[model samples]
Target: MPYEGPRVYRRDELTYNRYLKVEELLQLQQPQSDPAHHDEMLFIIIHQAYELWFKQIIHEMESCIRAMMAHKALPAYRRLTRIIKIMQLLVNQIHILETMAPIDFLQFREKLNPASGFQSIQFREVEFLAGLGNEKLMGVFLNWPEYRDTLQRRLDGPTLRSAYYDLMRAYKYRIPEKISREPDEKEREQILDALRELYQHPNHKLPVYFLSEALIEFDEYLVLWRQHHVLVVERVIGGRKGTGGSSGVKYLESTTSKRCFPLLWEARTYLTKEPQWEAEENEVSDL
Candidate 1:
């Protein structure tokens, strides 16, 4: 096989706007505010930006999952790195939302009732693809047929964690047989024990060790994004119930500690934090 360069054409052949559909994209923001409040445009654009990023994140995650299922660590690592970078962008993006004053948010907040971020289908898909799905969460979308159907597909689908364990098994790691949407303490302990060995004796199993840290970084950034989201919501809406009729900040507060990879996180606690240096070994943290 030969390497191919990007396709090129005459100067008038293809354009930036045509390639990106910029005009169509610009028209998609249809704010319902009758008077067109000043801050509503910002709100719409920010959310639209988020949805675009969410779509890309899903694209990257699906590729990563496929690679993991095929026991391809290098490709999985590449996608995981992209996901981590995108998630960091998401975490920082919350600050833009926080910049809107409560008064400005209230000017257009009423227009958003029943259309909360909770209804973000892609975000829910992200959660499911990342190994965080359950019937209770799926039930939240049951009232809407389209949303429920989408969620139902994810509920019945494969998850990143499941694929990861399969990858570990392919690599000859002694991972536990039991896998669940919500793993029990015993099941978690079994997985954690495997992780402990990987962390302690990482030199020989370099690829598995790389994947483990990638997963941990992914989980860590997810937690950060959720925490940042909670703070942004609290800043904008205070103690008010969510426009979607949920407990708002309180609900978000409760979910901040949710880990998509619980065993990977718990495994960290058992690690000997003291420096273990090998001059020839590159720092996995750099990945």
Candidate 2:
């Protein structure tokens, strides 16, 4: 039997450009600057790239939340690992923008007036998904009805923090029935105690321990990104007001301290190695 050579596909068949919509994507980077300053193209492309990565991060986080809620620590950990790497990439990407000299940026900066990074709906979505939802922040999107509605849903939805606590509760940890942004001293003590136990005796619950460490690392990287962003903005624009009317670097600096999982961070101060007798006593008290 004669072997038929691989059939040649028609031009209309799915080519790489068609599959990825490369043409449409390239067309989206329209510079608002008259005469189209060369650096402006770089500026627009960098942000578009960021938005693409943000979309992927949100996808991974949502899947991780579901995995956590289902008590599937391994899958959740994998997703978190991916998210941390993506965050690292994002942090490094800032350096590329830093390469554009402030003078070069100014050539087209004024054209961006009234348009700011603060208007990014997906950025807010990422924050809301991470348990950092601030209803007040929604004011930025009030005029964009579709974006506001989308963010409102995320504000009402389960967050990574809530899912993680639910997972911990399923594992019989002493998580409060209602975890609040500002927990009372009693609830705080209970949370710290549970975390202390987990950290001190990690061998007892290896999967949960691994997931907890990853969660904290995720939190740490987020802080690193914010800190790096503040530095970049300061380097680029000094103390100038943001195009979106923000205080620029000062505003970004404040966000560097925001933590998605405060309890995990606070638990660190309470972590300590206990004497052998105390360990046995604590174990017996649990029974």
- Say which candidate scores most in TM-score: 2
- State the lDDT of candidate 1 residue by residue for 1-287, as single tens digits: 78798777777878888899899998998888988988888899988899999999989988999999999887898999999999899999879877789998898888888788887889989988888876677676676888888777877877788989988878777887767667778877778888887777676578778877998899899889889999889888899999889999999989888888888877878988544647425645312
- Candidate 2: tens digits of C-alpha lDDT, residues 174-264: 9999977667899888988999888777666768888999999989988988898889888999999998888898899889889998989
Q: What's the lDDT for candidate 2?
A: 0.87
Candidate 1 collision pairs: none
Report the poorest 10 consecutive residues by lDDT, candidate 1.
278-287
In order of appearance, the predictions have TM-scores of 0.89, 0.92
For model 2, which pairs clash?
A: none
Where does candidate 2 have its weakest 10-residue lDDT segment?
278-287
